[model samples]
Target chain A: QGGVAIAECAACHGEDGIGKDVEIPNLAGQHEVYLYRQLQHFKSGKRSHKEMRFESRQLSDADMQALAHYYSQLPR
Target chain B: QGGVAIAECAACHGEDGIGKDVEIPNLAGQHEVYLYRQLQHFKSGKRSHKEMRFESRQLSDADMQALAHYYSQLPR
Candidate 1:
């Protein structure tokens, strides 16, 4: 499920959870809850990253949680 | 300089760069540029978190960069 959810994320945040660019954040080993909350914030407009907001809007609560867990487990 | 800048941060983001609470983000091994950009966003009100905004207001550009480097170097 996480692998499927993160298909789009791999473009900017690589398969290893390392970001493709300096401006992008590395998700590897980040706090799971924090990642989930940031996704929620993006969906609600509390966090203002245009692409993230659009991407997060496509996720369900379960999808977000799974994606956060998947990334948090990756080596930093 | 990074050590000095991270004094207050150690309270919430621990000395090891792991967050003390679930709501806080772990900074260990995060991309330096991304961390620096987030700090700038907090200071400029582009990102909204009450405590972070207040804390970031106290930093200069050099301080932010040093703090970013400091946390990014910690083991995740």
Candidate 2:
């Protein structure tokens, strides 16, 4: 469902779930609940950052959950 | 040299450079130069991401460089 969004995210984040670097932070193997919460934060302005807000603004609740699912399953 | 700064980072990113999850992105084994540039972007607002902006805003140029160096050396 969110494979498309994952693809876009992969452009910068990488196909394997690794981010660009330490500055970017890794998303693989994270808790699904945490991931969902962060995406929600980005979407609702609770997190309130410029880049994330733009990225988060584009996602639907379902999309965010899918992303959370995909990442949570990865190996830490 | 960057161990202290790295300590703060380890709170979220693992001591090994793996991030919290797939959404956060890993920093291990990334290009040093690329890492440096992104830190600069975060500090200068060129990247303009929210959570990153706040995080970057608190770092000194030296701190950023140190962080870049530490992550680039980790295994990807």
Clashes of each: 0, 19
Residue-level error in angstroms, candidate 1, position B4? 3.3
lDDT per residue as tens, model 2, A4-63: 899987876676767775445466665677679878977887655687789888999999
What candidate 2 gets wrong by more than 4 Å, as runs, is: A18-26, A30-34, A46-55, B18-59
Candidate 1 residues lying further than 4 Å off, grouped into runs, are none
What does candidate 1's lDDT look like per residue over B13-75, in tens digits? Answer: 998888999889888888889999999999999999999999999999999999999988887
Compared to the true structure, candidate 2 yields what TM-score? 0.56
Please, what are the lDDT tens digits per residue for candidate 2 over residues B30-66? 6677678877776787655677778777788888989
Best by DockQ: 1
Which candidate leads in lDDT?
1
Clashes of 1: 0
lDDT of 1 at B76: 68
